[model samples]
Target: MAQVRNKQVLLKNYVTGFPKESDMEIVEGSITLKVPEGSSDVVLLKNLYLSCDPYMRILMYKDTPLSLGFQYSPGSPLTAFGVSKVVESGDPKYKKDDLVWGVTKWEEYSLVPSAKILFKIDHTDVPLSYYTGILGMPGMTAYGGFFELGCPKKGEKVFVSAASGAVGQLVGQFAKLTGCYVVGSAGSQEKNKLGFDEAFNYKEESNLDAALKRYFPEGIDIYFENVGGKTLDAVLLNMRSHGRIPVCGMISQYNLSQPEGVTNLANLIYKEIKMQGFIVSQFYPLYPKFLEFILPHIREGKIAYVEDIVEGLEGGPAALVSLFSGQNLGKKIVAIAPE
Candidate 1:
């Protein structure tokens, strides 16, 4: 078998504080075209697209439990959700040329255990990169967190923090589809044009609590928690009675050594607010139903998704680091292959 040059983004060490592009190094590695003989339950992949998600930051910390037992070591390729084509497979459920999206290393090619694969890509009508964003994990996160946990009703007022992000954007749209009034908070106004009932730039707001009040005079019935810290503290004050808050990623607090404390727990009792944190994997069972609901809206132009894509494997480190600086305009993705 011929060996091919595999360009990889290697984690330099367990990260602390904010991550910088210098924390990762791009290096040339080599891999055989075929999976090692007799390696059962392994699949060789030609990685196409790699997703840059905020959850990945948690995985960079030493022995971070957020990784769910997957640990990163110095000089090892960083792991992320990606789209790939199967080059060889030892698993019965997959075969040569199968398209799949799931956990993959940040490299041109990867040999991964089959269990890490979330699902095989069956729908090709949309861009294959969609598997890394709107049609994949982020999509499912929004669906399960909002519809399942949020339990929002028609006419309810909903607020989404980091509303222009991959999952938050979808959550806001889903709220609108449910006949709810939705307002989103983003870092910039240019990135805030995602079909929400109203959107605000959190950076421009002198008081986030007042911003929420301006958007939801009646008070927020649902708050899709994305950015935590002060944003969450503000949302807590504006929550309506019987409100539901599905805690998603808290990007603002992810890199902090000391996470900010929320000061309004008493409001949860007084307002009877239901605030619950969720992991996307817990709701994988609802994926099929979510796809059925979202696909049509996508094809008909009823749904909109934004992606901030960087080209080539060499660009992975800077692209990943850009997330912390809010440099990427939308869902951050790296296109490793032409597809």
Candidate 2:
């Protein structure tokens, strides 16, 4: 194949609050499908779907460190996890037409430096797009954090805040599969219908603490904490003794210039609770184990997933900005091109 031109979404500048469409620009650039001469471990890929994660919104700040994830450098394209088809490879491990999932540039095409963290999509029987989300990062997060950290037991009562988001939805379903009673909180009533045994519209609730109490009259045994702050405080007051709280994300705190104060800390001591915060990257070694556990369930139709897909790179900026407003219904993804 010959080298070809590619379209890319470039970061126009650092951002604050919700990002605007003007913060990014789509431009065309050229790259060889063939690896450049002397390159030994590079893989060129055509991006199929780019994940629009909430974390990307935090990276729009120029001061956000590379350790958090790459900062979207000015004049350069943003990056994210995505599913792609390899068009060219300079590494012996990869070949043309291979389907893979890993970090990819937010553009029509990406040249991966090395396929180290990338994995091949062995289960083509499932949707290849699933690799971009439910079967990928979010899946791993739910499996590791909920099962491993939350340590849920059958019949235990579980609560998930931001329950309709990517990780929370899967966590709720996983709990149901374990015979646990599960309740979830979402911003709207429509999302409440998907999987939760009891779903409440957080926005409609007059008092968050009262709402949680109403759902878990016997108290919650485990909490998959996605939205922190007031939700966390409310959950704290309602936890059963020795209950587990796996702190996966605090999407509620991401946009605030300063974090909202929580007056309660004595509950952690009084209840003898186990509340731990974690980043999914810390659970990488368990990836293979997670795949082993989830693949069968997914294949058997025991698990379900939903996605909010935007048609092209042009919609990426607005779609990402919508995360703060709870505008996305499920896992948000950008279909850069056709499958």
Candidate 3:
């Protein structure tokens, strides 16, 4: 088989503070369309869409276990969740023309281990790009974190930080669906228009603690923790007795050299708060149940998902960098190959 040009987004070096587009470089490489001979349990893919997530920033830092023991390295293609089509398969579970979503490199084509492929795309009725956002990891994160860890009840009051992003938006909607009163915090009022019962611009608020008190005079029953730091500190002060806080991502602290400390954690003991940090992978067992619950809502338009899509692999670096700056209006995605 002939080798095809593979354009990739490579980490230029370890990042510090904030990531700039210059931190990553676009380079042209070559790959054969075929899986290597005698290679079992590996599949060749034609990558279509790439997900740009805040967690990817953590992996860019050198000597960090966030990359899972150097899974990513400088001068190598950045890894991310992506939607792809199988070109050739050395695994029985997949075959030619199979559609899948899972961990893949930021390039037009990839040769990845079959184990990394999370699931075959069974529901093509929806947009394939949805796998990069609403129907993929972020969706699962919101589902597992909110339903499993938060364990909210009807008529409960829920507050979500960074509620405009992929996971936060879904968490707010899920809370509402469960008959909870939902409030969301976003950088701008426009971004917070995702059907939450109430929305606040945290940037405009002089005091987040006062802001939360205003939103929930009765106190929050469940706090979906997305942006940590000051927002978390404020939420800590307002949690009702036995309130659950499902800590997902601490986007506010990801880039900081020294993360801000929450001085109000003593409130946890005083209020009997149940605060737990979680990674989405821990709840993969619930995925089948999650799909059954969410897919119908999606098909019927009972749920809404927003995405900010940039075209081509060349735009990957800027799209990834924009996540930290709030430049993208919604879930950031790169369309390497549109279907």
Candidate 4:
């Protein structure tokens, strides 16, 4: 046969509140191995590693798009940031067997437009799976949010919520690299995993404001906001005068039928804090710069990245659903095919 079997995880229905494993189904389909005769710049890809991020939850809802920029339709295979190897390419820029990472579907094989792929994977010294987490989008999110938005200064106190996450882990590391004092918070189950100077369990803290006060006696100079709601409210009360808060993800509120209200917004004014919400696309122009800044650190062992990888396409849905429960110890990844 000139075709290959494509195994896919399709969204069975639009998610209402919290997602479940039953929300997605694995479907088997067939695809031509070659890019069609006259197609230009269409790349046939063998998907390898899929990055399971919290933003994907937003897309699972009927109304909107996440970073990949498209709403998820019922019965359609979901799209995500992933690592792939080109099986065939009708484009000059990519040849057979080129390793690349960017937007790809949650399937064993994918046919993607060349533009969907951000760029060819140039460095092979690191595990290709790293492209799904540390060396790719999540890493960029932390770099742009913390260094560019949070604007850490030497000796400043920094705090990151959901710190063991794909982006937050890197954010704490970046804060430490800038000579700042770093503290992180995770769910009670994951607080013991080390990546920050100090760590606490948010689930165990009765008063988040008191928790922040205990960690940052003076005040936090930079707060890398990940799980919003109560965390943002508490951080607001503890922010230093003229402090910066880079709004990354609101994971705590994403699956809520009614999003939680953050009552301490007035604290932003009281403390003269700068709270800015940003998406990763705004930082793509600086990707090359981010690579130069981060690659050396990664190679020197100055940075550490942890990933909780689930092997096989069948496990994709559960792996993605794990984010809301804080089940993943670090970056959640779904491995489809071996590189």
Candidate 5:
């Protein structure tokens, strides 16, 4: 095959508060359509779906050290979790036409070095694009965090913050499947209607404590903490005794110079709350278990998911910036190329 290059979205600089479109730049780049002969370590791919997550915002921090997830490097292509088709392979584990999802760069083509991070997509009955959001990282995040950390019983009251986000939406649905009464707090009323039993707009709520009390009259039994500003403070005050709080991403505090402070430590003593923070990588061992549990539901259409896809690498900058402003409808994704 003739070697063809592609376009990519690149980071322009380290970011401050909310990221602006100027922070990212669209540049034409290339990857050899063919893998180098005799090199058995590389896999060449054509990327299709690129995920836009809130964590990507944190990566824009210039001084931030590289962690388990991606960190932004100025003038380099922005990295993200994405789905792609294997066009050429030097690795024996994957070959031509194999579909995969993993930590991929936000470009049309990528030369992935690590086979460990890539998962071959076997279930094509459902949307292959789902690997970017619902059936991918966000799915693992909810399954690991909610089911593993925030153990819920039937008829328990569960609450989720930023309920419309990639992780939050799945968490709410999982709570419902567990036979718990699930309510979500979103920034808008339209998003609140997706899967939540009851949805409230946090901006309209004058007193968050009162709002929580109204929704969870019996106090919250399970709290999926996605937003950790005033909402976390209020949840702490209203938690039922022995309540479980699965501390997911705190999107509300990502851009702040100093994160929001919650002055309710004393409530923990009285409430006996169980609060734990977790990362998806911590649950990689359980990915197969999660797939077994979620794949059936996904294929049967018993479980539903929403995604906000932007076309072309040129839209990557705006799509990412929209996360902080809540401009995206569902899981924000960049479609670098058509399948």
Candidate 6:
């Protein structure tokens, strides 16, 4: 195959405070449309959908703890969860045109080590872009963090922060499935359409603690913690005894140079709350289990996922920066190429 021009979104430098579009640039790079000779287990991918998530901001750091997983280097294309078609491959497990979802470069084409790919995407009945979100990493995160750690029971009150996001939206729906009362808070009140019993715009609330008390009068049994900082502090004060807090991504503090301190953490001791932070990789073993559980609900029209998609690689920078500014309404995705 011939070499082709690959448009890529590259990190210009390490971000300090809030990120702007200027922090990344779209550049034209070149790649052969085939796996390099003798490159065992290498797969050449035609990138399709790139996911814009809050955690990507963590990787943009010049100094990140090694335990945080991968980090982005200046002058290189960003890596993220994406849906792609295999253009060529040296691995027998994959072949030309095989649809897969995994960690792919933010470029039109990527030559990746097979290990980064989670699995081949088999079900094509639903939208392929979903692999970047509800059916992908975020889905796994919500399932493991909520079910595996949350341990919800019937008639319990559940609160999800940043509830309109990829993980939060699904977490709210999953809580409903478990027969729990679900209330969510976001910058906007769009979560009501996603099956949240009540949705509030946290931006409009002058006092978060008062807002939570109004909705969760009896106290929250399980708080799916997505936004940290002030939201977490308020939830701590409103928690029921022996409540569980599944610490998902803390979007509120992602772009902060110095993250705000949570003043009510002492409530964790008084309430005997169980709070645990998790990485999605710890739940990869549950992918098959997750698919089995979610796919049926999806096919039955019992669940919904919203995506805020931007077309082309040129829009990638703005789409990514939108995550921090709360500009994206749902799961933010960049369509790099046509399917």
- Which numbered prediction scores highest in lDDT against the true structure? 6
Q: List pairs with backbone clashes in candidate 2.
A: none
Model 6 Cα lDDT, one tens digit per residue, 164-194 = 8889999999999999999988887454559
The models' CA-based lDDT, in order, is 0.90, 0.83, 0.89, 0.88, 0.85, 0.90
> TM-scores of the models, in the given order?
0.98, 0.95, 0.98, 0.97, 0.96, 0.98
Whole-model alpha-carbon lDDT for candidate 4: 0.88
Displacement of residue 224 (Cα, Å) in model 2 is: 0.9
Weakest ten-residue segment in model 4 by summed lDDT: 187-196
Q: What is the C-alpha RMSD of each candidate to the true structure, in Å?
A: 1.1, 1.7, 1.2, 1.3, 1.6, 1.2
Candidate 3, residues 199-280, lDDT tens digits: the string is 8888789999899999999999999998899999999999999999999988889899999999999989999999999878
Looking at model 2, residue 263 earns an lDDT score of 72
Compose the digit string of candidate 5's lDDT tens values, residues 236-298: 999999999999888888888888899986788899988998878888788788889999988
Candidate 4 local Cα displacement, residue 272, angstroms: 1.3
Model 2 residue 48 lDDT score: 95
| CA error at residue 93 for candidate 6, angstroms | 1.2
Compute the lDDT for candidate 5: 0.85
Between prediction 2 and prediction 6, which has the larger lDDT?
6
lDDT tens digits, residue span 1-339, model 2: 565878888999888766788889989888767788888889888899888887787788778743644567889998888998888788878888888888889888888776533688877888878887788888888888998899989999999887778888899999998899999888856854555798888889889889988999999999999888898988899999999999888888877778788777788898899988887777767878878888898889888888888898889888887777864578888898888
